[model samples]
Target: MKLSPSVTIEQSETGLEFIKVASEFCDATIFLQGAQITEFTPTGKKPLLWVSQQEDYQEGKGVRGGIPICWPWFGVSQHEGWPAHGVARTGLWRAEQVKEEENSIYISLSLPMNQIDEKYWPHKTKLLVEFILSTSLEVRLTTTNLDSETLNFTQALHTYFPTPAIEETKVDGLQGSKYIEFGEGPFEQHDLVSFARETDMVYTQAQDTQRIITPDGIIEVSRENSRSCVLWNPWIDKSKRLSNFADDEYHVMLCLEAANVLEDSVELAPGDKHTLATSLRWV
Candidate 1:
């Protein structure tokens, strides 16, 4: 573990390595495993990210909350018996750089192809997740195709936002997008989204910005170089089936992920690169 004035490389009680940031504007924590950010609290405001209180933080298992990097793939595997949400979330990433600016602190972590299992994704690629922590949290996930041929994949910055009560929270700016739930209808969204039941919807033709109205305040979620967003809330029954998640805990968290899934999946030629990014702030 390494310690600095603004950043620290530390290990969790469960022996997982993470980078901790305490800047002039906010405090954040990013786990080297999966290159995931589990906490982001801007000064004088509620936390911008949410993590499960029951999260085990164990190796080879993803933490229940914050921003889980769903890379190479998102959701269930097309292949039989493969891990859902790909292997990047549980694989240990290498921290490459940390820099402090006047107002924000930046950290970069990378996952190399050598660390991945060829059976699941055989492409030789490089994955990097960069964090810019300040009054707002900004994340950028970049993928570089290092192989000779073209590479394609789906991905998401699966971000969980905290709400005083899930039932009372509403998301704005998806009013005109088209969505599909549980692989069902490409329903059109005409109103602000609110959770009623086990909500899982993939939205397309979405705007670049959305707002989450929570009891605490309005959280502004903005995206770049992305066209798909996912809204999910496991209301009652499905919550019981999730690992490291409490059945009743679903009442306090909701996910509005910025993603490139389904029709928005990326295809990169040799030596090509793509970047997917999202930013969050309390407005």
Candidate 2:
């Protein structure tokens, strides 16, 4: 497969390109303006998570918006050879297949050996990501456990929620759930309550569905076979550091990530199938 194919790729006047991968049920629209995602009508609209242009990677800076699928590792590096974020994200995915119909477009992108450093991971596997773009954006990522043994990994759908104010915003899905604060400064004292300043938390064994209602819009997030919910939003200083993020960017973007990590890591048995899904709808 060609990393940067010479095939004819067209785009709209706004520089947005839609793709449907053949033989796979997935599709996606790439907004070239800031490489942001304006619409991911997957399954329905329940998982339209990442806020458009809320954050972006400046050549010398870091990565920003577009539903960044935090996989194998989340956030900064926890292992060797793995940069702050995984390499798969920065790499260009090859469109090996595309299936289109009048109502929806299904696209599939795979990362071959030539495009990735297999030495970091000894297993011979194919990362198959499918985007079902319609009224709602549905994304399905399948790691074909090509090797004979089980593959242990962590993953998260880092969905950024748009809001009018961080103080007024409240996430409704984990009302009574238990969580652990992972950052600095007396987290247990002031962080146990609802939305406030610079909120960052990880809720374990969360319910199947979560809702984020803000002054800007109402977002309903649902997932099948999910065990945890991670919520984060950089209110003041952190927001200013992000390249595309304005001084008041938090007023427009919130992170309500659907994740499976830490103690809840997924262990896929050999040839065994494990799938995680989330849907977002604007209300």
Candidate 2 wrong stretches, greater than 4 Å: 1-28, 31-38, 41-63, 183-194
Q: After superposition, how far is residue 15 of candidate 2 from its true place, in Å?
A: 11
Can you write out model 1's per-residue Cα lDDT over 128-177, one digit (the tens) per residue?
Answer: 88998889989999999889999989999999999989888999999989
Report how far off residue 126 is in candidate 1 (Å): 1.2
Candidate 1 residue spans exceeding 4 A from truth:
none
Candidate 2 residue lDDT tens string, 90-188: 455666565556665555666564656665567666676665655556666666676799888777767666666667777776756777766432222
Clashes of each: 0, 33
RMSD to true structure for each model, in Å: 1.0, 5.9
Report the lDDT of model 1 for residue 57: 93
Task: In model 2, state the lDDT of residue 38.
Answer: 40
What TM-score goes with each of the models? 0.98, 0.76
**TM-score, candidate number 2:** 0.76
- Alpha carbon lDDT at 202, candidate 1: 95
